[model samples]
Target: MLENPVLADLATDLPQAVRLQRLAAHLRARFRCGAVALLQLEADHLRPVAVDGLVPEALGRRFAVSQHPRLAAILARGEVTCFHHDSQLPDPYDGLLDTLVGEPLPVHDCMGTRLEVDGKPWGVLTLDALQTGTFGEDARAALAGYRVLAEAAVRISRLEREVQALRTTPPLRAGDDERGAVGGDADQEIVGQSAPLLRLLHELDVVAASDLPVLLLGETGVGKELFARRLHRQSPRRSKPLVHVNCAALPESLAESELFGHVRGAFSGAVTDRPGRFEAADGGTLFLDEVGELPLPVQAKLLRTLQNGEIQRLGADRPRRVHVRVIAATNRNLREQVTAGAFRADLYHRLSVYPVPIPPLRERGNDVLLIAGRFLELNRARLGLRSLRLSSAAQEALRRYAWPGNIRELEHVISRAALKALSRSGVNRADIVTLEPALLDLESNTAVPPAAAGATPARPPAPPPPAGETGTAPGPLRDVVDACQRAHISAALGRCQGNWAQAARMLEVDASNLHKLARRLGLK
Candidate 1:
């Protein structure tokens, strides 16, 4: 048997979450700490994925790194860092310890270390104690050793799961493969095996079993609706109706009626009684897409429905009870909307009882290629092409280009490029269609630096005035550079359809920096 019980336990074939929880429990027992928790880094927040001694509510709470100095500092470091015994920083685990009853008692000492896997920071492993100096130097050293084992366990578990997925996944028929919908269920299946994607899948699996309101948060085109559908399919209400309501598309005048039904003569167009989406989705799920666009009056009504499971239809005094499990989605930050008096605070909290954030395409690494291949196959089938593939250079370009529009943009890009390639091949009398980098139409400056994938070299800066000849006589070199910058930024903004944030991402600069550059270049 292995000397370390934690490591030995992790080596067993337990589920990933179970193994993680066991690790946390073991660490807590070994160190005699008040609590031990494993938090996963999701975007800008540290979400407790597994906990040993923390209160059950802590598992649902997400702590923003910026708001938590200790977490921010710990994430910044590669090794463990312990807070002072008398540190005054507010604990994220305040009132979250199982031992705590009413109000939060101050924690005496806290230590945290960033959990890294394959050189990437995965998350943080935190240990908190009620007594001072509980986590001494010896304990910190032991924790560091445990961290390595934790990472190994995670990697092993992930690899095993991926292997299992591959083994169990049925092979697609030639026709289905050509259709580009892997598994023959494009609408239902979520592709990619990246760590982030897998984590999301696991979160979905956990939340799917519950009837809690789910709020899907992510940038546009990250497929929040797809996740919502998956959640509904996995839930007990799969057999019931899954009603979709586009809050953004609903007019202010009809918003109330659209959500909560209308009796005859309730409004100018209400010729007959109409059951709203909530009633239509009774005992099932109501997916509210772009929920942030809901007007304040409608929001209040929605909140009432969420709170009391009752909805008063238009021109009706009595309320009808709805057994709908709501799954709301919005690219907009609802918390910010709540602060701005746009979204109701209570409604926001209610909808976000279980928030699931979808990862954007750019952040998903090589999964981009996998998704691109699916799109390529789709385009090939649509165009009736025998073969359509990306050239090595085209593949590099696709990987390098920041997918501002996420998966949706990727599909369009692949489709457009395939069409262009098909046209070119027809003109050239070629049997096979291969898309080149130029066909991708990615902005040169906005694309990732060529050194990234080693497929191309960066173009040397304009040969600099041809020795002494002052090229073009456009004032100084500074002016020429500024002009070039202005043109490049303008082109990027155009490519991103005037989304400044997307433009900034394409240009590989901070959004504020891009704004400053645009202003300085007179291109704002």
Candidate 2:
């Protein structure tokens, strides 16, 4: 017990934090008490840091600051409020302690000291006496001596907060040129912060400063738009507008006019001259979403613009020059499309000047929580939720889900759950303080819910097999081997949480070789 000299000196000397939890354990053994708990106050809250002589499982459980009446009275006014028994105290925490200790805490004999440092309430150091009338004034005074060290620990915390505040500055305005040079929390925006995502962010940082055409390849709803937006924000054209066009949404009849502006009376609908997306996005960026959906004819026009940096308005003879960077996104296999004559080989080469592939949510390690936290903050007010938190079980559920819609799907789940809770009658906003397992329950049960009424499914890509291979019973060795290899890498990536090195190690290949295979298989 004397080995905890650090704690003894802290009561008078340097006044730093000392656990002495071992000492508390020894004390419990010597005194034969039901429980001995150390509750420390920090950051304006009373947190239970250590415990002894009680259930081992409840060791790290915490009670809210000043929530328990007896503890509150002791710390608030230096009055040693006594609990005759656990039943008399009103169950503070679902009665875990009462059940664990096998009896209500002895009220008449139980005593604890109000730890006050520099005359301010810091914490409570208590020893519960199970027998009747076993504690008196002497015990409270003995525990009070530990206050000095507790105060020093609080000082250290204050210093650390100050240091962090100094390091993180506020974001710059959109108009600021500097905003384009250095992005606003680029890594944080990426969600996962996993090893693969970190490396991806590093690559983004290196490429964002240039005006290179970036092709984002990923499965549907894998946050390609977010990466494109980040790229625009970090580029020299940050101040310029970013125009988004879904190539798949455009009708073939008007796709050309929509892309490269038309002159007056070019067609029946062209009553007046109109600038197309190319002209509108002059000196900015044009994000061609679902690039593979562009008709072959439209693809030829797009190729010309990318190659020549010029656009010719419809019904006009001369071409007009426009300086605009292009960012294309596709969930389709462009290489297969090229072979099938659905997509232009020339356009593919032009758009993929710089390609960045995004991994799916299931492959992103622990990003489920990160995206969940961000979505909660963003939609809390819109959903009319006062306070919310994810339960441990709910967090586990979110981690387990393979989010087919990626970050977009996660946001929808949180928004739908919060709104549903708010609409419930007699439920006060404060009552909905935490998002429990029930909120996540709605997401997993149904693939599509009435709550997510208008959500469109992401269309699957076309087959990669050759026409002959599809009819045959089996393909050649190389084709079957390639199919198996892609499936293996994709499964391994999901299992390893997008850690390329670990996935490579499991596959027994060099990391560089794995990278080559991933590119060939299109498993990002």
Stretches of model 1 off by over 4 angstroms after superposition: 1-184, 425-430, 444-524
Q: On residues 1-524, what C-alpha lDDT tens digit does candidate 2 reach at each position?
A: 53255355434333122334544564455445556666766543455555665433233234444445666656665655455444354322222232343432323345565765566676776666556545545544444443344345444544554464344323334666544533443232455456677777767766877889999988756778778887787666777778889775676789999999899999998999888998988988999987877878889999999999999998888999999999999766677668767779989999999989887787887767766765654454445443444555666888887665566667767776676566667767544345566765533322311112112223322334654766856544654555557556655544443345555777789876876665543343
Native-to-model Cα distance after best TM-score fit, residue 111 in candidate 1, in Å: 59
Which candidate gets the maximum lDDT versus the true structure? Answer: 1
Candidate 2 deviant stretches above 4 angstroms: 1-175, 181-190, 423-426, 442-524
> What lDDT is reached at residue 333 by model 1?
64
- Which pairs clash (backbone N, Cα, C closer than 3 Å) in model 1? none
Q: Among all windows of ten consecutive residues in candidate 1, which has the lowest summed lDDT?
A: 448-457
Q: Can you give the TM-score per candidate against the true fold?
A: 0.53, 0.53
TM-score of 1: 0.53
Query: Clashes per prediction?
Result: 0, 3
